[model samples]
Target: MEKHIHNTSLFSKSAALTLTAVNVILFFITEAFPSVRAYLSLNSVLIIHGRMYWQFISYMFVHGSLMHLLGNMLGLVFFGTAVERKLGTKQFLILYFSSGLASGALSFAVYAAAGMNHVFLLGASGAVYAVLLVFSVLFPRTLIYLWGLLPVPAPILVAVFALIEIFSQLFSVNSGIAHTTHLSGFAAAWLYVKIRMKKSPLALWKEAYRK
Candidate 1:
């Protein structure tokens, strides 16, 4: 049983590490070959008119800056490994990619609705947000440090982040962050988690009301 558990644990961590490496390697490749960004990065108008649907997945691996890459990889390594361990490699991969694709779809719809269909999005923040959220759900009482100091419970932290993103999205803030996609990821992941747990999405709220 111990060996079985050990083997189960190994795959998830390795998969998380591989994902982080791929993101970093792709970032460097795009840096050295700038033209490659056109093919891999998300271009909203091109996707709608030109049918560059592959951008939905490809854009998740590309980053807009070193800081962006660093921040995402840090989250991927920290929260991703834990979530992967909980879900196993196959489910983890499904969650990661599906949340990313969902975010892309929602972003496209929002851009089209806002008459800003030409605005492009690029980054793995959406997928990372999903992983972070899953971590929060699975380990709600875990204390997460803010700036290496102020400890906050995981659920509260996730809620705070979601609220911030919603606020940013509603106000059309010039923060350059993809708040819509971030919120979409959180929604997608929340639904996915509910399905996986064989519970209705509102069950948690119902339980809280009963309590």
Candidate 2:
């Protein structure tokens, strides 16, 4: 079992930073060569008809815009570093890639079922959401600022995001946001914590608050 407590520097060399750098570099590469985006982005049609299964993993490294890349990388750098320190590099990568792949698989199933093969899903929002969820579970009491103001507990922030995603998915299906993928991230992370970590996220949050 991994210990709940860990000490590590945030800026130290880690998998999280490596991922951030890769995402940034790929963003620039894809920007210079737009055709690369089509190959990297997840599309149900491409995977089923063209046998481009690599998109499931590559989609996480490609972003639609600068803001998209910045948002995901910031979340990764912030929450991922802490999670990696607690879980160690190998376990952290497992959690990250597994959550991302699960999200992509679930999304592919949904898209194929609905016959929305033309939709292209890109970005690391899914994996980043999973990292954020793991971070909250590991540090429930940590304060996260909302828009540079209003300190909120990490768990509360995650709960709020979950609710927003559910609402958006149901009422705003055309919002151009992959709400399903984001929620899948949370679901995948929760299962990873329960089965691999042998812990309940809710129980950990409650325990932290009670202390």
Best by lDDT: 2
Superposed model 2: Cα runs more than 4 Å off: 1-12
Q: Can you write out model 1's per-residue Cα lDDT over 60-98, one digit (the tens) per residue? A: 999989999999999999999888888888998999999
Candidate 1 RMSD to the real structure: 3.4
TM-score of 2: 0.93
What is the alpha-carbon lDDT of model 2 when measured against the actual structure? 0.93
Q: Model 1, which residues run further than 4 Å from truth? A: 1-13, 200-211
What is the TM-score of each predicted model, taking all chains together? 0.87, 0.93
**Candidate 1 collision pairs:** none
lDDT of 1: 0.85
Q: How many backbone clashes does candidate 1 have?
A: 0
Q: Write the per-residue lDDT of candidate 2 for residues 1-211, one digit (tens) a residue.
A: 8768564854355999989999999999999999999999999999999999999999999999999999999999999989999999999999999999999999999999999978999999999999999999988989999899999999999999999999999998557999999999999999998997588899888888898
